[model samples]
Target: MPLDQIPDEKEMSFLDHLEELRWHIIRSLIAIVVIAIAAFAMKDFVIGTVILGPSRTDFWTYQKLCQLADLIGTPALCIDSLTFELVSRKLSSQFMTHVSVSFVVGLVLGFPYLFWEIWRFIKPGLRPQERKASRGATFSVSVLFMMGVLFGYFMIAPISVRFFSTYQVDPSLQNLFDLSSYINTVTLIIFGCGILFQLPVIVYFLTKAGIVSSALMKAYRKHSIIVILILGAIVTPPDPFSQILIALPLMMLYQFSIVIAKRIEKREARQNKES
Candidate 1:
């Protein structure tokens, strides 16, 4: 789409776009702040229950692992216990932790609305066909992001917490974890996975824009596997089981992205032939 053909006038200066972006940022921030206030109000439930759920060995993940161990005849899968002491060293640590954690929780919950606001800002610049072509973008992005967030919180976060809490250099060294550190790790994993899981949606757009194709993705399958494994290793613990667990889902997402790209290509081709 050319500048003159866009809904916004071609005569509008770059400063005009900047001004529009400022409003978008303001709206996004307001939404986050409102949600943060709600999160803070639900202090006990959000902090004591949801945020710290994985800290206990009786979390659903541990129970599932135990059940899997029984079924597979692998005692190693049964997590009996995790040892770690959560502590606050500084006076302001707890207060800061509460505020920051609430903010992060707010952001996670408000992600869809945030993205919607972004879409609203960008949609004005898009041609009618372009907007139509990207229909359901917000819904698909939200669902994928939330799914990834849940996976990280329920699966990856618990596994990481269990592994790190149980790891020890020596019998004499006590495992004392800082509250801030723990929350940071959990938040990073949740948000990271959420962003990474947009692979399929990203591929759709990239293919539509003619930046990449399904054929390219198919040709690089082996290389993609190596990259996926490397990504898994970067995100997960050094253990092969953990790496493979992360890699498998990533590879599946890659394959799914290829399919999405191919569908987009075929659809575009059909539309062009009709035209």
Candidate 2:
């Protein structure tokens, strides 16, 4: 090896590849840490307004529902309050929750940058044709991921919080939610839905790799819907409305994935014919 010479990717050893990946991971961590510090600094706003919003009756989602309730003459649709008492049993619980929530906020906000770094590492390993097929992948994946996060935040979190907070098996029963558990549940739901929204991107690559096709997806449409509904039930409160809310978007995503697979199939067919 020549001194001060850059080695070709193909010439790089496994350790060299690992070193490059380590740097990418470090940079991604730095981005998340930076965001986390900022979130930690804004403790009141991040915790009170963002994390606790869904747990309050005055959240934007609840306000919108109240308006819809008025318009539809359905007073029951208006969520006036959350009946649960959120308590921190441990003396350090609040402080620990703040730190953990800050990190989660960082992860959510820094997701695009983190994924971009991973993509950079992976892109060089992909074939040129594969690279071309996945152009704008970073942007598409980031957008879809954020959309899912937002949808889960606005659509699922509030409803689930309200339902669980208010639901009672007996009049003597009380709902006392742990502060950390409540916040963690909200963050987990958002992150889970964000990951789920990568279905289209996953399908596109799978289609290109010939492991999946539009025909298979279309054939399994009913099965997919059943699975999505089950997922919605699992992630959301066991209410039909909450389940429907999550299921509707996931169903749409599955349909969109089918379209994406079909397009890939068509493009490959055309290329084969031309060649």
Candidate 3:
């Protein structure tokens, strides 16, 4: 439908808007389910390699850590082995893992399409100027999500797994992890990082909406660093090395977000002056 033909907020009845929204949501769900079926079909590769890759010493994260340690002369950065065994104690645990993993895969694979569906729904409600302003949002969001997912898988998740696997209260103690717990760790890492990586995009939108500004971000810079460091400590190992590892990248992202906000502010100022 053309912009003039599209129903305005007051012109459309609530139920009419709801009906349109329902279709959009249904289409998005269908896309995810289809992708999930494909993921289920590739169960062997997904479970054996993609899901379990972080538990192996030869994983990319370990190799990178080893190289960094060698360069810096840090012996503790070594990851010799993943000491824990992942076991399913309940009869239904394995089946649950399969379902959970498939759903996660679906979400990751279908995210861009899902967002596009969302954009389609909202575009009709936006002004031409607003739509034009958001032209690059979809691409940027997709790229950021993928980068975050890879970072979680290859950097944050491995360090976390290695740290927990080797952590012991006593010499007699051994770590035998549950399948559900392991899946939770991996999926949570991927999704959490993916969402966190949207900081710059979020700032851009908030700036567009006039809810936040670059000067505000600048004022909170110190607090943001403290919060980032705290989050890094929570997610990564107890060691300062791992905490710093996570915090540094996040700090860089925060700085980037500030820069984006500054540009948006400058653009808005220019438009205001022109008017």
Candidate 4:
């Protein structure tokens, strides 16, 4: 259909909007499946190198920690080994896990395109100024997501895995973990961080909608610190150092969100004055 022939959001009925949204969702799913198929083909590398990297003692994070330990003359940070094992109990557990992991990898890799499709569906409903204001939203969101994933994979996942794999409740028992559980822990932390890293983007939209202000965020700084510390404890190992490491970045992100909100407020004020 020509752009002129198609009805605007105001002219379209509720069912028409649903129909449009359905198509958008279908396209996004198709993109994910295509990418997932490719990921499945490279399962060996993805699963062996990427997914299971944190489980090994010689992993980059452990290596870095060892170096830091040497520099500081503290042997506590040096992790010589991971004292745990992964086993699959179900008949089809491995196969099913491979399939699920491929799909998740596809979703993470194709997030930018997925958001593009969603943005296309939403753009027509927005005013010209709104569209202009949201320019680069997809890129900004994608960058933040990737950064969070890397942080989780490189820093958070390894630390958590090390702590859990080594900490034994009893000396007589061995730490044996299910393969599915291990994968879930790794991916959950990765995707959770990826989503959490979008704090500034979330604040941007809220600020744009006049639902949030920088002053409010500033006033709530102390409360946010407490929340961040709790979140750090939840995501990280039960150690003060690990919790502080996680909380530091989150605190920075919160401060950055306040800056974003302030910029938006200033821009709106300037626009108002000009109008």
| Candidate 2 collision pairs | none
* lDDT (Cα, tens digit) per residue for candidate 3, span 1-275: 32335746547768777877888899899999998888888998888789998988888778888898999999787787788999999999998899889989999989989998887877878888898899988899999988888888888888788878988999799899998998898788788778778888888889899898889999999999999888876665566766786788888999999899888888888999999
Clashes by residue pair, model 3: none
Residue 68, candidate 3: C-alpha displacement in angstroms: 4.1
CA deviation > 4 Å runs, candidate 1: 1-13, 237-239
**Each candidate: what lDDT?**
0.85, 0.89, 0.84, 0.87
Q: Tally clashes: model 1.
A: 0
lDDT of 2 by residue, 99-208 (tens): 99999999999999999989988877777798899899999999999999999999889988987887889989999999988987898778878987888999988999
TM-score of 4: 0.92
Please give the clash total of every predicted structure, in order: 0, 0, 0, 0
How do the candidates rank by lDDT, highest first?
2, 4, 1, 3
Evaluate model 1: give its lDDT.
0.85
**Top candidate, metric lDDT:** 2
Q: Model 1: per-residue lDDT, tens digit, 46-142?
A: 9888888889878888899999999999999888788898999999999998899889987988899999878877877777788988999999999
> What's the true lDDT of residue 249 in model 2?
89
TM per prediction: 0.91, 0.94, 0.91, 0.92
